[model samples]
Target: MVLQGALGVSLTFNCGDTDVAQEAVERSFAIASERGDPLDRLRLLGPMQMLYFRTGRFGTALHYARELAAVAEELGDADAATLARTFKGVSFHLRGDLRSAREELEGALSGRPPKEVASYLGFEHFLAAIFLARTFWLMGDTDLALEQTADVVSSSEESGHPLSHVITLMWAVTVFLWQGDIEAAENHIDRLETRAAAHGLQAYLAVADGFRGEVAVRRGDAAGGAQRIRAALKELHAARYELLTTPLNVTLAEALCAIGHHAEALEEVRAAINLVETNGDLVYMPDLLRTRGRIEAAMGPRKRDTAEATIHEAVTLSRRQ
Candidate 1:
C-alpha cells in the first residue's frame, strides 16, 4: 500500500489520470492509518496532504499537515517535522490566515538552514519559503516578500534538487508576475519550461505553458495568449489541479480585458473569486477583486462608481491583512 501511495504521486505528476491517482493516494492513506507502521503513515500523509492542498481542499490539507507534524514529533524526525510545518503554513496562507502562515513558515525555516531540510513527499523548505514570500506580499511586506522569493531560488539552485528547482521557478512566477516584472517572469517561464520538460515534470510544464501565455498577453498577443492559457488551463483542470487555477484565470482575465472583452474578463475574475471562496483558498481574493475592478472600469463610465468601490474593497482587504 505504501508503494501504491508512491505510485499515486507518480500518476498525479507524470500521468494525467487524476481521478485514479487521487483514489490510489486516498486508499493508501486510509490503509496506512488503519494498519501500516508509523513510518508508513508518515510516508502516506505527505502525499495525501499534497493531493488535498492542490485540489483546493485547504481544510483537509491542514488536517493532514497537523497529523503529519504530530507523527513526525512522535518519531523524533526533525526533518519530517520541518516539512510538516511548512505544509501547515502553506495551507494557512491559502486559507487567508497570513499571520499564522508567516509564523509557521518562519518557524519552519528558523531552527535550521533550509539546506538541512529534507524533501518529504512533495514539500521542502523551498515550498515553505514560496508561500512565506507570498504571505509577506499579501500582508504588505513587499521588500520581505521579494527577499524571501530570491532566497527560495538561490537555495533551490544550491541544493541541486530538480523538484526544488521546478517548485521554486514554477511558483516564483507569481511574485514576479504580480510585481509586473515581465522580463523576469518570462525568463523564469522559459527556464521552467526547459527544466520541466527535461525532468518529465509534465504538470510544471503545463504550468509553464500557461505562464508563457500570460507573457504573450503582455507582449501584445492577447488572442494567442488567451487561447494558449485556456488550453493549458483545461489540461490542468482535468488533472484536478486548483492551486494555480486562480492565477491562470487572472491572466486569462487580463487577456480578455486587453482584447476589449470587458464582460468576459469581469466574469472570469468573479469566477476566480468564487472558487477561492468556495475552496477556502482566499489567498488570491484581493488580486481577483482588483482584476474585476479593472475590468469594470474598462466597461465604460457608467461602471466607474462600481469600479472604484470594487478597487477600494480590494485595497481594504489587502490592508486588513
Candidate 2:
C-alpha cells in the first residue's frame, strides 16, 4: 500500500497537478499512521514536505520537516535523515535564511556517503544538488553553480531520472543567461523543450517555455518571447501552481521591456514582485527586482535612478555570503 501511494504521488507530481499529489500524500500519511512504522512515516513525510515547499507553504513545510526529522532519528536511516535535512534546508532557503539553509544542506551532505546519495531515490541527490547550486547562485558564485549543475546533469543521466535531467537543464539555462551566453542559453532551452515533450512532462515543459522566453528576450525577440511566456503562464495556471506563476510573469516583463513596452513591462514586474512578496519567496525575489529595475531604466529619467538603485540592491543581495 505504501508503495502504491508513493507511485501515485510521483505520478501526480510529474503531471503538474499539486491537488492530486497532495491527496496522494494525505493517503500515504493515513496508511503510515495505521501501520505505525517509523520508516514508513518518514518516507511519507518526504513527499508531503516537498509538496508544501513547492507550493510556497513554508510554514507547513517546516512543520513536516520537524516531524520527518524526528521520524528519521527514530528510524536511524542515514538517507532518511539526509532527505529530511534537505527538505528543511529548502524551507530555510526560501525564507531567506541563507546561513541556516547552507548549514542544513551541509549537514545533510555530511550525513550521506558520496557514492550513495544519488542511488537511493529519485529526489535523494537531485534536490541536494539543486539546493547547493541555488545556494551558490544566490551567493554569486557562478563557477560553483556551474560545477554543481554539471554534476547534477551527469548524475541524472546516469540514473535515468528524467525529471532531474529536466530541472538540471532549466538551471543550466539560468546559469547561461546570467553569464550572458545567449547561444548556450538558447541551446539548453531547445534541449529542455525537446526532452520534456518527448517525455510528456508538462511541468518541466512549462519551465522550458519560460526559459525559452527568457532566451528570446535576451535576443531582442520580445513579441516571440511574450508569446512563449504567456503560454507558459497559462500552463502553470492550468496546473494550479500559483507559486510558479511569478517566474513566468517576471519573464514576460523582461520580454515586454525588450520590446520597448516599458509601461506594460513595469506593470508585469510589479505583479510578479507582489506575488513573490505575498508568497514569501525570497529565492525568486532577485529576478523580480532586476526586471523591475531594467524596466524602470528603460522608462527614462523619471525612474532611472530608482531603477538602478533597485538593481544594485538586488545584485548586492544576490552576492551576499
| Top candidate, metric TM-score | 1
lDDT (Cα, tens digit) per residue for candidate 1, span 1-321 = 867787788887774587878899988878877895788888888888878876778888889889988998988988878877888898888877788899989888888765556666544677888888888877778899889888888888777788888889888998888778999898888888888898787878878889888889888999999999999999787767777898889989989999998888888888888888888777778888888989999999999999999999999887765
Write out the backbone clash pairs for model 1: none
State each candidate's clash count: 0, 0
lDDT of 2 at 143: 87
Off by over 4 Å in 1: 73-77, 115-118
Cα-based RMSD of the predictions, in order? 2.0, 2.8
| Model 2: per-residue Cα lDDT over 237-303, one tens digit each | 6765454576678878878887788889898888777776776667778778888888888888989
